[model samples]
Target: MCTLTLAWQVFEDAPVAVAANRDEALDRPAGPPDVYRASPLVIAPHDVEAGGTWIGVNEHGVFAGITNRWTERDLAGERSRGLLVADVLETTSAADAAAHVERTTSEHEYEGFNLVVADAEDAIHLGWDGSLSRTAFDPGVHVVVNVGFDETFALPAERRDLGERQAESARAVREALEPRDDERVEGWLERAGTVLGDHEYGVCIHGDGYGTRSSSLLAVGERTRYEFADGPPCRTAYEPVGIEGQF
Candidate 1:
């Protein structure tokens, strides 16, 4: 499970902004953001183990991300959910991506997950547990955790505390961005970095076996930008990644 927040058409100058903190076992092997050699040309981090990705943006100006759903099940050798975001990036618009998630009958082979696909004008959240649910995001701020949007999905009692923390973090982020003076992407990135590192909860979660690995901030406007932090936001700075080359 991870933490992700989205601001859709929240700013006049910048139509879309997303902030995410990816939590996983520190031992998982992955690479930083790079141009994904696919039909639509995506920029995302490479999940070496699964040969997929967690977050990415395509040349069509569509940005996508996936988060694991908290459920009691073991799909040990099943298909990787990390690739879902990249798969959605293959489409040209958020509507097409949502359609892919809605009609894809093959998703049952994978574990529970939430996939968010967004373009300049549209944003969609597709949730798949045993069944599927879709939410067309309105022009406002939205937060999603592993339990699904607004914590509508079931979560074990032991993990409920962490889930609450995630919800609070989302509210904190929204408050921080709602009435800001600066409109530049750089300013948003800097503010996002601070909020992503909030230690009250797992926004920058730390534990014996699992913790935050990296943080990503994507801004879509006149020109799209993706900034990645190689390590935890508490100790790392975000760097702008180039999506032109394979590296």
Candidate 2:
């Protein structure tokens, strides 16, 4: 996931709502949302090149997503960060998942990343840029980009400058996004799709052989609801995925 907007504990019925866009190279192969794990019923799209996912959710109502944190140089991580998202999803609850991520990431090596793991009970943001840090934030609307919007971390001058330049596109999108009229998470997802697709906000990118590739909307409450757009949200329509009421 390149950019993620989460409305945690903002709705009356649904405690979590998310609108996320995955930006990647055009040639990178990927599949739409599907059943990846059977026991707990994990739903996520596959990064065909890496055999992992950028975002996913489980039957336990746990949601996990990752966004790359821009660095001065483009370097491949020893391990794909998306796999970390998958690992955290295996846990039953958000807090447990978060603790697992903290321990695992501290022991392993991954490139710069901003990770969000959350369920109705807990929401945690973990940022890594050669170092690791964890943050707990209040419930409300939050936007995370490559540089990590609300989840801040110390950085070298060069790296920070690079982030300022590269992360502006995602920040622009967040600024231009309008609030949803209705309170329901389902309604917010529909409204988010409209604005998220608009190039005017820089949410939908048309770059040189690289741009926004896929989108996901999730609402977690008594029952979980998920919808996915296989292609760029601007040109593709979202369809329901997983079991309608659960899973």
Candidate 3:
């Protein structure tokens, strides 16, 4: 995943809402959403090469997703970061998932990554780049990209700003998350797609063989509803995915 925006306990009724754009080379092999009856009972899309996932939700109501962190060093022979998302999905709580990532960073040499793990009650943001740190989400919206969490919205320091492209993308997503009176989850999902399709900020990045491959929208409350678009949101419509057996 590249650009991720999460709304946590920000809406009156919905406790969690997530919009993510997975940016990668167009040739990478991946599948749409499905139920995996593995140890943690996952519901996620699959990455064929690494046998892992970019985003997923487990039976325990734990939602896990990962964003690559920009770095020049390549730690060869390390585990795939996609596998980290899969492993964290097996945990019961957001805290446990964060801890699971912390443990892995301590024992292995992997590339940089920013992970977001959440449940109905809380969300945990973990960043690993030779070191690991955990941050709990406040009752509001937050955005994370390859540079880590964007603190410019919460803090006034210029140093907290994200990269130019990422900052622009975050602004677009934030505008899309403005309050809407409609109570239907579908409305929010549609707005999420709009944010993903916004090209002004590169939310739907594409050029020179790399681009946004898939988009996902998730709403978790009394029930979890997920919508997935197989291709870029600019050209694809999100289809309702059955997540009954997943949780």
Candidate 4:
């Protein structure tokens, strides 16, 4: 996933709410969100090229998403970062998942990435820009893009030329999201999808060889709901992802 908004422990009923858009090559083959594992109940859209997922949630109420950091260097990892996302879903909690990342990245090399792992009780953000650094959220709304997680989009001057499009996109989305953070209310996830689909913000790109491919909205808690769109949210309709007894 290239762009995402996470509301961790921000709701009375839903402790973990998420909205994300997966940006990728137009020709890249991918399957819609589905149960990939039964043991721990993993549900996510699968990247056919890598057999991994860019985002997902598990029975444990653990949510994971990744955004590739902007860089001129080639992605050198032997393993796809999406696979790491899959491995994390197997973990029981956010802390365990954070440790998994710490240990795994120490032994393996991967492209620059920004990752978020959260549960009802705990949440963490891992920024991997050559080297990995970890952080904890203070319980509220947050935005993450190719530049990594931030309370607000602070476009780096050095990267503006190379990543301004995505950076500006995040800025626009953040502008739309500021109210939710200030008022401390609900429904931000669905509203996030609406803004993501808006062309003005550049969140939904068209006529571009590479752009948003799919979108997802999820609520995790005593009652969990998941919705997904096979194509860009701009023109495609979203369908509910059934997780009947999984969670």
Candidate 5:
């Protein structure tokens, strides 16, 4: 059981928003976000592997999201999950941070995984299968799943329609927030909820066997905000929260 779903790193006039849903769940682990938490700003319901994290944010406005790098099992490393989270938050730049993670990962053994790291200036995607590494992300919105393919891959006809729908939803979200009122944060949240309404990205739910254990909505930028709630409905009624301590 694991969480699988799409995440949006939204930048509004007020604050950046990280909104996501937990697709599935296995055994709930004991952690800071009990729901989801890692060292410092790293926050996710659980690790991608037994010891790896899937999504995390640092107090420094550094954020990362990891997905299984689907590939032949031949490539992997021995890096601990905790180390991965720690390395990114402590590093100053995405390139330096990626290098630190890649170097350490090469020495250790682990499963295939893709990590998305972002700071105020840049966002990077790192694909690793233990033996080889590739970086494939720039700025702007990108979608990731449990599959391996660059952004250039042509979408199937059916998927193209789905993509259009998601894009439209995303656009609507952007348009609705054009005014960016402080009180409208709630409206923005509602719009986000509406955009994701009834859309199940399968990966997150994973065949009912694994229901999302937790879900998170995060916003970064000048003032970072993180909101967490249980999965399925993916609510945000709780207080608008911030990561405690420094990265």
Candidate 6:
């Protein structure tokens, strides 16, 4: 299981932030970010065999990522989540991408998952549990977990207000990037720690057994950057690695 977070500047020309963690069998051969000929854009370490990605961006100013929802069975065989992300980035506008994913992947049998996609024009969130549901994003801060719920799940009073705090902190970072201020950038970076402080597995072994196995933060601008960590209060950017092939 994994976690994916995004922060977007409400008043900037095209400022966006993203963070994610790629959780697999732990023994899978994964590469870092690199440019490929088919898509011919920089993509995060993608599992060629699996045909999906944790995060990636194209020169056309499009970005996309995926988070696996904790469910009873594996969904990999039903549809290729990575390919879905890449397809959206390469071919569609953010406004209609979610529907495309839903319509295309509906026939395949899968567990469940959420996808976050963005472009200069719009951003979208999609939740699929063999069925498809989606919501368009307004300019601001938002977070997506593996729970298959929208912002509603983002707040839970019982968690010591952790979810609310994280959401607020994420918004702060987005505001900081509006003017692209260094101080604000630093401040946002610092606050990012607080937002991700309570990182937990997407699936709890003691409970659902699908707790978050990793977390990530990604930002896209003139250039795209990514940071990943095991638990919340996540810090550090990962070096890009290269992957080959295209679907």
Most accurate candidate by TM-score: 4
| Candidate 5 displacement at residue 24 in angstroms | 5.0
Off by over 4 Å in 4: 72-75, 151-159, 179-186
Task: Give the lowest summed-lDDT range of ten residues in model 6.
Answer: 201-210
Q: Which candidate, 1 or 2, would have the higher lDDT against the true structure?
A: 2
Task: Give the C-alpha lDDT of model 5.
Answer: 0.50
Residue 71 accuracy (lDDT) in model 6: 45
Candidate 4 TM-score, C-alpha based? 0.90
lDDT of 5 by residue, 1-247 (tens): 2222222333443233444544434564624343243434355444544554556666556776665544545743555544575567666656667777778766777666656666666666666665655554543345444343334222235456544443444344334334343444445555544343334423234344555555555656665556665444433243444454433
* Model 4: colliding residue pairs: none
As a whole number from 0 to 100, the lDDT of residue 243 in candidate 6 is 29
Give each model's clash number.
0, 0, 0, 0, 24, 25
* TM-score for candidate 6: 0.67
lDDT comparison, 2 vs 3, better candidate: 2
RMSD of each: 2.7, 2.6, 3.5, 2.6, 5.8, 6.3
Q: Point out where model 6 deviates above 4 Å.
A: 11-14, 37-42, 72-76, 154-217, 225-237, 240-247
lDDT of 2: 0.79
In the predicted model 1, the residue pairs found to clash are none
Model 5 spans with C-alpha error above 4 angstroms? 1-17, 23-25, 30-52, 75-77, 80-82, 149-190, 193-197, 200-208, 234-239, 242-247
Over 44-102, each residue of candidate 2 has an lDDT whose tens digit, in order, gives 88988988899989988899999888655454578889888889878899899888877
Ranking according to lDDT, highest score first: 4, 2, 3, 1, 6, 5
**Residue-wise C-alpha lDDT for candidate 1, range 135-174, written one tens digit per residue:** 8888876767787664355665778886666566655656
Which has the better lDDT: candidate 3, or candidate 4?
4
